[model samples]
Target: MDRLEKMLVDIRAFVAEREWEPFHDPKNLAMAVASEAGELLSELRWVKGEDADAHCREPEARRRVADEVADVAITLLMLADRIELDLPAEVHRKLVKNREKYPVEEWRGR
Candidate 1:
């Protein structure tokens, strides 16, 4: 299976092992997503512009950013699974919608 699929399998097992699915209502999962995103922001809070890219190159900083980003993604994947949403298909739909919402001719050169 693909990496995402494998991760989902592992996540399901993790949650099941802890009997945490019952506690992961939509509201709590959304809150967890927001909290994890805030943590991602914190990793770059002090950096500015192109400098933030360099900051992320530091091993420890990179690890921190990766961990926080993973947390956000994990929570989102769980939310999608819990809600019976096809996350990849939904992402494709949004991409199509955005192609219209942000027509290329009008947004090309910045």
Candidate 2:
């Protein structure tokens, strides 16, 4: 199978192995995604621009960020799978919508 499909299948198996599908409702997954995103944000909240860049360069800090990001990604994948969404298609669709909302020609380099 393709990488994305395989990832989804793996996530499904992981949840099933834990008997977590019952708790993997849309709202729960959405909340988990938001909570994980907050954790990810917390990693950078205390650091300013240059320092934030350097913080992520540190091994431990980077590992923490990766863990938080993985949490968000896992929840998001579960949510999308629950809703039978074609995530790549949805992302492309959203980008098209966003391009219209924020046209690059109007805001480029500014």
Candidate 3:
């Protein structure tokens, strides 16, 4: 299986081991995604936008940020699996729509 599929299999086994499937309905999974995303945002909450990159470059700060990012990704993947959503296809479709909405020549510099 591909990497994503393997990850999903592992996640499923994890939840199964803990009997978490009953608590991981779509709504709860979506909420987990949002909560994890909020935690990720909180890591940079006090940082100025212009300095954000530099702040994240610090080793400790980078580790914390990376942990939050992983949490967000894991919860999002769980939510997608619960809903039977095709994340890769949906992301590709969204990017296509975004390109159409913001064509390069018209939006390049502005």
Report the lDDT tens digits of candidate 1 across residue range 39-109. 99999997987799889999999999999999999999999988989888999999999999999999998
Instruction: State the weakest 10-residue window (summed lDDT) of model 1.
Output: 46-55
Error of 3 at 26 (Å): 0.9
The total of clashing pairs for model 1 equals: 0
* lDDT (Cα, 0-100) at 83 in candidate 3: 90
Model 1's lDDT to the true fold? 0.94
- Candidate with maximal lDDT: 3
RMSD of each: 0.9, 1.0, 1.0
Estimate the TM-score for candidate 3: 0.94
Off by over 4 Å in 2: none
**Candidate 3, 7-110: lDDT as tens digits:** 89999999999999999999899899999999999999989999999989999999999999989988999999999999999999999999999999999999
Worst lDDT 10-window in candidate 2? 45-54
TM-scores, each model vs. reference: 0.95, 0.94, 0.94
Off by over 4 Å in 1: none
lDDT of 2 by residue, 79-100 (tens): 9999999999999999999999
> 2 or 3: which has the higher lDDT?
3
Q: Write down the TM-score for model 2.
A: 0.94
